[model samples]
Target: MSIGASITVVAVGAILSFATHVHSSGFSVIAMGGVLMVVGIVALCLQIAALHRQRQMTAAEVQPPERTVVVRPPSEY
Candidate 1:
């Protein structure tokens, strides 16, 4: 979801850039660019959070058992 959102944000940015070049944006190119950049950063952060959560779950499921044995020298015994 986050990845898709980020992609969409970039696509929108590209469209805006091209549209501005073809037409004009005396109104607010800076505003559009700023919004797109903020949205993209948010999406990227979300994706990163999702990945970290997944890793945490995987680690929890794969933990090794604690029971184990060790051998000592007969002479010491």
Candidate 2:
């Protein structure tokens, strides 16, 4: 997902893990939240790294201009 989505997931996960208290016979809310948070953080990190790599690749792809030397005829003495 995008960065914003990842952040939202992390925020929601934090709220579920810390703010709410609900006990059920099924899966634990806190554990699920923790998992979501971890996945979101990993996605964010990978997205950032990919962006960084793209920038580096583009920079490397650019070619600098070539310089030329000019020759002039010798002036009569």
Candidate 3:
């Protein structure tokens, strides 16, 4: 999903670039390109952050527990 979203952003950015090249006047085209580029970058960053977080969580689960024993006294001997 993230990959597809990123691809779509890039495609839109390309289209904006082409539009700006041909029209060369409307400010909207430049703004649209910038917005699309930012979206792609942010999406990529989020994906990387998510993977890193998952990896860290998994790694943490691997080590043994810090406090293992719970003591309780039995009834009268």
Best by lDDT: 2
Write down the TM-score of every candidate. 0.56, 0.79, 0.57
Q: Report the C-alpha lDDT of model 2 over 1-77, residue by residue, as the tens digit.
A: 88998899999999989998999888899998999899899999988898899999999888566888699999999
What stretches of model 1 exceed 4 Å from their correct place? 22-30, 68-77
Question: lDDT by residue for model 3 over 1-77, one digit each (tens)?
Answer: 48678878977887786666644565677678878878887887888888899999999999888887878888796
Segments of candidate 2 deviating more than 4 angstroms: 65-77
Clash totals in order:
0, 0, 0
Query: By TM-score, who's the top model here?
Result: 2
Over 4 Å off, model 3? 18-27, 63-77
Ten contiguous residues with the weakest lDDT in model 1:
16-25
lDDT of 3: 0.79
Q: CA RMSD for every model?
A: 6.3, 5.2, 6.7
Clash-forming residue pairs, model 1:
none
Positional deviation of residue 29's Cα in model 2 after best superposition, in angstroms: 0.6
Kindly list the per-residue Cα lDDT of model 1 for residues 1-77, writing each as its tens digit. 57878978877876675566543557666468667867787887889899999999999989988988799767853
- Order of models, best TM-score first: 2, 3, 1
lDDT value, residue 2 of candidate 2? 84
